[model samples]
Target: MKSLAITVWGMMALPGCRPGEDGEGIALVRSLPLSDQQKLCLEKMVDTFLPDTDTLGAVQLNIHRFLDKLIANCYPEEEQKSFINGLDILEGKAQDLFSKSFGSLENLQRESVLLGLDNEENAEEKAFFDFSKEQVILAYTSSEYFLTNFTNYEMIPGGYDGCVDVPEVPFKV
Candidate 1:
């Protein structure tokens, strides 16, 4: 558990640690600097899941930093920017509709916003939001919290364990 928490913090702190596009091993891409509005959006996003200090400290994950790596590694440069921009747009709409940003909304409220975005007759916005959410998920999973905390990394000895105790069977004729 402590290790998981450490990994989460490491992920969050990662954005500033690596530098320049030439860095190696999923470490080269620079994080897009957040605008004031985007910062507010991020705050809302963080708040959406991080209400209590215990929970926040428990995970200690830097979701944004994880996102930075995901976009860098998985997306083309042009598409990545556009996809991220779409997050800003979604957040803006969320703020307009609910008087709170997307990240700040309650889970149900966030889902409702997503539902509206999905149901839109406009094809472009739907595509954009879908991609954005997909990116968010990718970012989340790549975070150290997920890599270290949520998964079992221990080496297992080679053999399956099905039955703990078995009765000896008589030889069949």
Candidate 2:
């Protein structure tokens, strides 16, 4: 359990760590750097990447917003452009391959589009997809819904040990 918490924290914190910041909650503000179509497609794309199974999925937790906010604040201008452009790349691919917009694709088709993007021949294209995918996953796993209900991670975890003595082990070999 502790390890899971650690892993989640690592995913969010590993990207951007600086003074006077908690590392988490870094993606709280969404600057208007993306177009409406891009945003809509992005929402659909993230939902496809992490569909609702036993728990609320990425879109339910607004992880696409998280990714956008993180990119706005933490990412360089070049990287931000790459991310937004990646959405266009995805849309183009969706049109070329499936004859549909990314937002309109069936779940499996959307998943295939993203998976295929990973194997794109262009390094920048692949990098953009990879970066966006990583951000979405980090945001989803570290989301409040995932933390509280799924992982049972309390904001102030309950097992406080102020002054407790450990009892001796019984039946030592």
lDDT of 2 at 106: 92
Query: Model 1, which residues run further than 4 Å from truth?
Result: 1-28, 42-59, 72-74, 103-107, 147-150, 155-173
Model 1, span 1-173: residue lDDT tens: 99999999999988767664887445355565566666556544433433335334212466655565556666688977776676677787787889986766776786667677778877767987576566555655566655666676435647898978888999999
Candidate 2 TM-score, C-alpha based: 0.71
**What 10-residue stretch in candidate 1 is worst by lDDT?**
50-59
Instruction: List per-candidate RMSD values in Å.
Output: 11.1, 10.9
Q: Which candidate achieves the best lDDT against the true structure?
A: 2
